[model samples]
Target: MTDTKNEQQWERTISFADGGTRLDKFWGRELADEGVSRGRVKAWIESGLAKVNGRVVDKGKYKLAAGEKTVIGAAEPEAGEGAPDPVRGRLDVLFEDAAMLMVCKPAGLTTHPAPGEPGPTLVNLLLHRWPDIAADKSGMDEQRPGIVHRLDKDTSGVMAVARTEAARLKLSADFAEHNVFKVYLALVHGVPTPAQGTVDAPMGRHPSQKTKMAVVDKGGREARSDYRVLWTGPRGLASLVAVRIHTGRTHQIRVHMAHIGHPLLGDAVYGPRESAEWERRPDLLAGLAPRQMLHAFYLSVFHPETGEPVTRWLPPPEDFCALLAGLPRECLRVGVVGMPGGGKSALMRFLGAMGRPCFSADECVAELYNPGGDGAAMINQRFGGAYTLEDGGVDKPGLFAAMRESDQVRREVNDMVHPMVRHRCEEFFKAHRDEPVAYAEVPLLLEGGWHKEGMVDLVAGVRCPADKRTGELRRLRNLPPEILAVFDSWQWPEKDKLAACDFVADNSAGLDHLEREAERLDAAALAALADRDRATEAWMDGLWPGLAGELDRERAGGEGPA
Candidate 1:
């Protein structure tokens, strides 16, 4: 597995003969020429900065397997002895004390000087502000004397600087023990579902791209990020998200966001460049900034000497705010409608796999009928215990028998359950307002007049051939022919449903064929969303022809738009 020739940086694919070797041992031998110590390799593994087969692995003793790949990002070489160059720049100092200071580092500023490369950096500005910071050599690098933790060069926000050696040492220890609280704001291309959630995937160096990072499954450390949707853009084109990270892995937020399929807008490295959205709207793409739309807007840490928690938050930069103002503001909601045995469940599953939030009416009904649920009691009250079983539960077979006896029984059950299901679906949509696209499978959507009620942005119909549908019902569900016929009669004609729906998915063929059709429909839905956003923008433009330009100029002039 060792590639001795390019010791400083190399990735290796493990063959069958190299299987079962410890990851650290394998990498340490491979990167021996880069002066990589076994201890350093172990540190990398424990820090979640090692990868195997494109996934993060936290254990150094993880045994390699055949056909697995590993990535090694060797540490930067130590700098030669030289006097640090001090450059002048503006620094937004948030807090100051004898022990330490907090400053808002802007995007595009390097934290410290690199070996042999002497240009303006945040460290230089620190030196210019507090000359004594150059003398406080508490950090590992002499060039970064008073620095503790550092953000990526392009990431901006609150950062702490130590003014004294004692303060630097104390702060460094606090960071090492994960005592700092870091919050970032990002503008991502799609809204994450559930409004708030956690990404607990481990992170490590990208297997092939030396400069990038990825979520790996071997030789990586634990990395977790908690994110909440603050706001979503028009038609779910973009979202403003707040993220709090528990572990300070390199590119953790970027990698995790991309892993969840909502990469930050303008993130050229992690975001997809050749996506349909980009291809359709090159003008919108051209408006994006060169850097990723990530801002470390908030931080909280213990005071170096006082032992008191200090928190600070800074608003996002002008460019970030301006970009958001120009984008659209509507969310996407889709309703899936189909008859029994028409593959509504399969369609919902496919949509969910594509990162859309999906809700099933059948699942909701099941929840209502579960043990000790209120639906059973309601049924007993309505039918005078005729449908109640010995276990005090609603006897489904008895209810079906009653339904077959009288159409009034079926209507009564629908009256009891349909409103509850609709209420649940409404709550679901409200909770997931930040999502780009949300889907709900309502089998009786057209029959119940939900589409006419304006509850969905678009309706999708799933169509299956008559013989195939009957065969599926007979083989898979053992549904009686009479019951199936009743269900079919309750639904609208297939041709009418297909004509009414925005898109139709044919499930008569195999699943692969159905999946292909679903993908095309998904793409079409996204395109429609984009079109709605554009229409909204055009309407706004018509209302105020130069409003957007004026706002951009105001932002550029350091004044936020009203």
Candidate 2:
């Protein structure tokens, strides 16, 4: 009649120093923890059942290194085989009374042994500290017999352990029936807009990324979260959120936020690149924060024996606070630039395709021209209605009339459009947090010397031969040689355009060639991204001091990002 299904847990250490051992490469390594076949270690990750340091450990090519810590993923805890002495572990006892126990677990401690547990776990320590605990272990499993639920190694929080089996069942029932309420404090990078929200994303393992989870609509468990905003920053956003979960899926919070375009401040595995505005900078998250900024801050439960409602609270750990305060200013700017007619518009369209915040210079111009004044009408006023159609549209004659009216008037039009162009361009950068880059279609990039200054990280050109360009122009307008000459003089030479470019894509080539060239440009972009990632990784190197999760970072230094 009560919730009776129990999920077992396992832990283990694997030897991989000989050369390089993949995280999933159990081909030769002893996976004694679960009797799980080495071949299936990769499958476990793919199925969303295996995790390393709490995130799915998905890669099969992760060469094993020496002294790497490994945790086994099983549905239930393995039965302890021997009557081992209690190994004393450091447990911050929150409240201990004759009827129940509460303790704060730090980041790196395990809930129970996957296997080969040497030190005394909280249960073992409690047993050693209280001899009567021996009586409490009568019907529990051999391994983690007393453990009810768990927090991942990186999640620091208050955990409850029962001194009696009956109390254990009742408490377990409380959790299963959703009678216990728990709250976590997370320091995520961006402030969630609207100051309050909920993310109802279903979580599953990433299709390709072994160590991450994706929010899939189908074939995944339903997870719900309620979050209230905390703060905002130039780097992106910073928020204090109260999280409530209906389903206890693996990485429910971390995965959901990342799915909605925000990752926690220090969750290296899921936090990096997912919503960190560093998808292009994989290495940026390499060593940035100490660990995931998830903390179990508040918990409410009813007393099993006394029927008293228990409420417990913990402050945000020091590490979480530090991470919230550590985001950088420059990392938040997105820049967009391109040579004139480089199809910066097309590129902007591409950015739009890639989910970038965008603004069109041409669109802005049209908006401005129509603001309380008719462009064709004003233009007609300068030239006359001869160019106007019956519908009041500016006649072609009107365009020439306005151009010849005064050089200053022409300058005025250009002035109106250019700054608005620049304004929107800057806004896009700020909003996107300075992604790889954005494009600004300035026809006179060379003359304006915009490329030499700011507005873009790389000044690139989209090109076609002069003859091809002229031929297209001729197709449109068979103007006098003098007219074409005037136009050509206004634009820079094709040779100069090519030379001035940081990157050049020959649109003169066929579509396939242009696509290939675009790929080349993308490669350059990825390389630039990588370099930025490396720098970020190096800057944050050696940041967290104490987390050795099953493995330590020092042992795996220079192995992740850089």
Please state every model's RMSD to the true fold in angstroms.
18.7, 19.5
Residue 512 displacement in candidate 1 (angstroms): 58
Tell me the TM-score of model 2: 0.46
Candidate 1 accuracy as lDDT: 0.74
Best by TM-score: 1
Q: Cα miss at 381, model 2 (Å)? A: 26
RMSD of 2: 19.5
Residue 471 accuracy (lDDT) in model 1? 83
Cα lDDT, model 1, residue 57: 80
Off by over 4 Å in 1: 1-81, 115-118, 136-140, 274-285, 329-562
User: Highest lDDT, which number?
Assistant: 1
